[model samples]
Target: MTDQPPTLPTSMRAGRILGPGHTVVVDVPVPTPGPGDVLIEVARAGICGTDLHILDGDYELARFPMTPGHEFAGVVVALGEGVRRSALGQRVTADPNLPCGLCPECQRGRANQCHDLAVVGVTRDGAFAPYVVVPERVVVPIGELSFAAGALVEPLACVVWGLERVRVRAGDHALVFGAGPMGCLLIQALKASGAARVAVVDLAPSRLALARSLGADLAVTPDELAALADVAPLGFELVVEATGVPSVLEGAVEHARPGGTVWVFGVAAGDAMARISPYTLFRRDLALMGTFAVNQTVPQAVALIQGGAVDVEPLVSHVLPIDAFAEGLRLAAHDPTRMKIQFSFGDASS
Candidate 1:
C-alpha cells in the first residue's frame, strides 16, 4: 500500500445520469473522503439491472445528475482522517448501501430497510469516476481475487442474503426461473446450499446452455417445465422467481411443492404487482418471501467467488471502457445474448 500525494485532483472524468434515458461522460471534481473514509481508484464497474432502472428514473431511491455505478472493484488510493493507511493500494470491493445508524431499521439489524438510506451510485455519487470516496467500514479487501471477481461480490452478496431469508434444505429440489446472470448465480448458490437438483427455466437457449455448463441439472424452456417432474415428481421444494416479471411469479408459485417456499429475488418496478392465489398458499402452507440488497454477506460472497464455489467469469459477455459506457448501457438493455456488461477503467494499480 503506497501513500498518496497530499494534493487531490481538481476534476476527474465520470459517467453521469443527467435525466431519464440521458447520460454522458463529463468532468466532475474529485470527491474528498470525509473522516473515516477512503478514496478508491475505480478499476471495474458492473452494469446491473438496477443501473438500467436508475437511468430510466424508475428506481425510487436514485436522484438525477449523479455518477452511476454501484458494483465496482478498485484500489485504495488515499486514506481520510482517522482512517488507517493499511488499505492504501489494496484492491477491494464494497457494499454500497450506507445506513443511518440511528434509524429504527438500523437498530433492528435491518439496515436495508433504513429510513434514511443513502447508497453509493444512487443517493450519492459513485464509482463511474476514476476515483470515488466511500466509508472505510464497507470496504472488503479482494486479497488475490481478480478485480472482475471482486466487482461481482455485491451481486453475489445479494444472493447470499436472499438464501438466508429463503429456507433451502439439503437434498431439497430447486427450480430457478431465469437463466440470466443473477438467475445463473442463484442456481449455483442454491446447489451450494445443498439442493439435490437445481432445475433452470429460461426463454433463451444460449443462456440455458450456459446454465448446463455451470452445473444446472436440468435447463428447459417454459414449455418444457413438465420434464422437471422426472426429478421432482410432486414439485420443487424451493422455487425462485429471478426474472422480476409479475407473470413469472405466478409460474414460480405454481412450481412450488406443498409446504414449499417461493423466493422472489428480482427487482420489479416499484408499482408492479404480482397476482398469486392466497387459497393455494394457505392450503399448501407455502411461504412467499422477497429479498433486497446485501446485508452482512459480502465476506461469504467473496469466499464463494474466490473459493470457486460460484463461477462468475463466464457470465461476463462484454467489457467496454468508460468512454463507451453509453454503448455498453444500450447493449446491456437490448442485447439478448449478453450476460454481464462491465466497464473496465485503467489498471487498478496505476
Candidate 2:
C-alpha cells in the first residue's frame, strides 16, 4: 500500500476508555505517520492490566479518550518521507515507549528513564485501532514469527528488563508470586537464566497450570503453599512479586529467605499501601526494589523468543476479532480463567 492509496475511513473501531469508564467499541480516526514515522496495519494486539487502569483513570500518567493497547504486532503499510529503516509489508512489533535519544537519560545510557518518553496507548493513540503511526526506530522486525507471538514481545521485553535488574545467578531458587502473563514470562526467563527451581503461586488454577506448561518446576495455588512447607521450609533465594496486590507484596517479604532479593514488577494502584516490618528489612538484609517499563531489552527479548528459549503460545488463551474488542476487554477483566486475550484485524487463521 502506498502513502496516498484510496481514501480510507476517517474513523475505525477500537476498545477504549479503561478504568472508571466502561470500554466500548468506538470509532476513532485512522492515524497518519508524519516524517520519520511509519503507519502500521495492526494485525494482533494483546490486552494488558495496564489497559484496565487506563479505563479507570487510575494510571497516573495517562491521558483521557485514548485507545489503550500497547503490546501489538502489525505490518507496515506506509512510510513517511525520509524513513528508510522500514519498508512496506514488513511484519513487526514496536517498543511502545519511544525515548528521545538526545535526552539526559539517553546520554547516560538509561533511555528507559528519558524525560521525554512518548508511550503508545497511554499518552498517545495506540494499536487498538485499525491503524497506528509510530517512529521507525520503535518497530522491530519479527521475521517469520506469528503475529500473535510478535505481540508478546512487549511484555517479554519488560520481563527481560526486570530479570536484568535482579542479577539472577545459577542454582538460585526463585518464587514468583502470580502466574499471570508477566509471571509466566518471568518463570521462563528465570529457568533460561539457570535458576535451579522456579515455583509459581497464583489464585487461578488455569494460570498455575499454564505456568507449569511454561516450565515452572512447582506451581501451586496461593492456598496450597502451606502444604509445600515441607519442600521449601526456608523460602526461596529470590522472590518476584508480579501480582500488584498489597497483600501479595507483604507475602513476598514474609516468604523470602533471609538476604534474598524481592523484585516488584506489577503496578499497584495509587494510594494503595502495603505494611511491612522495617526491623525485618533492616536485620535480614533483604533487597526490595521496583522495576518500571522496559528499557533497551527488546532485542534481547526477541533473541530469546527466536532461539526457542521461551514458549509464549500457551499463555495466549484467547484470540478475538477486532470488532469484538469490548467483549475481549470484559472477558479479560472479569474471567479468572483467562490468561492472555488478543485482538486480531485480519483472518483468525493467519
Candidate 3:
C-alpha cells in the first residue's frame, strides 16, 4: 500500500526579480510536479554571481518576473507520474541545466553548450521559494548530507566540469585570481586534483585569510600579486581568472609559464571585453579555455563533498531566511566580506 501524501500549502511566498535591479517576494500558488518530475521542498538555496547578473538583467538568458535560485538542496515532498528516480522524503539536490536532447551539443555530451538551453532559474521558477519542481532525471540524492553543503553541490559541479576540461598535472603550481566562493572552490578542487601548490589573489583580506585556511599555499592582496613570482620563479604552470573582471582576465596569461594553460572560470558581464595579446599566447604556447555552468558533474561534486575532498560549509558566510531574500541578494552583490549567501526555509509555507 502507498503512504498518504502530506498536505501542502496552496500558496507560498517566493522571491522574484521583476526587472533590472528590482526584486520582490510574492505569494504564488505552489507548483505541481508534472510527469517525470518531482516536487522539492527547498531547505537551502544559494545566491550566486549568476543570480546577481540576473537581478541586474545582465545575463541574457534570465527572464524577468522569474524566481532567481538554482543552487539548492531539499527533500522530495511529492512525485509526479513516471517519477521513479526520486521518492517522497528523499534528501536531494538537482542539476538545474535543462538542455534540449535534440541539440547537436547535447548529442555530443556537451549539454552546457546546448543552443537552446533552458536553465532552471533563468527559464522557469526556481528554489527561492518553499517548493520547486524539477525533472527526476536531474535529481541526485545527498544521503544524509547537511542541506547547506548540499546546496553548494551545483557550484562545485561547475568546478568539477572545468577540472575535467583543464590540465591539472601532479605537483603543478597554479595561480588563481579571485578568492570568492567560486575561487575558493577552485583552490580546493585544484589541490585535490593534484596541484602541488596554489596561490590565490584577492583584494579582500578576509577572503585571503579564508583561502589560506582552506589550503592555499599563498594568499595575497592584488597590491602584493608580484609576490607570487617568488613562489614560482618560472611562473605558474596553470593560471586561472576567477574574478570575472575584464581587466583581471586580460592580464592572466602574463602569469602563466611558457606552454602553460589559462582557465577562465568567471562570469563576466555579457558585453564585457578583455584585451589580451595573441602574440603572447602564440609565443608562450598557452592554452586558454573556459567552462560554463554545471554539465553532468553533479555526481562528482556530491562525491567530493561526501568523501571530504571539498569543504563547502566554510564558504557559506551568510544564511538568512526566505523573508530576507532581497537582503541576501544585496549582500551577495555588494558585500565585499561575503562569500556564499543562502536563503533558508524553516516554515515551508512561509
Q: What is the lDDT of residue 54 in candidate 3?
A: 92
lDDT of 3 by residue, 27-146 (tens): 999888888888899999999999999988889898888998999999999888877667788999999998898989999999999999989888899999989999888999999789
Model 1: per-residue Cα lDDT over 112-190, one tens digit each: 8899999999999998888888999889897888877788889999999999889689999999988988988999999
Best by lDDT: 3
lDDT values of the candidates? Answer: 0.88, 0.84, 0.90
Pick by TM-score: 1 or 2, better one: 1
Candidate 2, residues 67-86, lDDT tens digits: the string is 87899988888888789889
TM-score, prediction 3: 0.97
* Candidate 1 residue pairs in clash (backbone atoms < 3 Å): none
Q: Is candidate 1 or candidate 3 better by TM-score?
A: 3
- Greater-lDDT candidate between 2 and 3: 3
Best-performing candidate as measured by TM-score: 3
Ranking by TM-score: 3, 1, 2
Judge candidate 1 at residue 168 and give its lDDT: 88
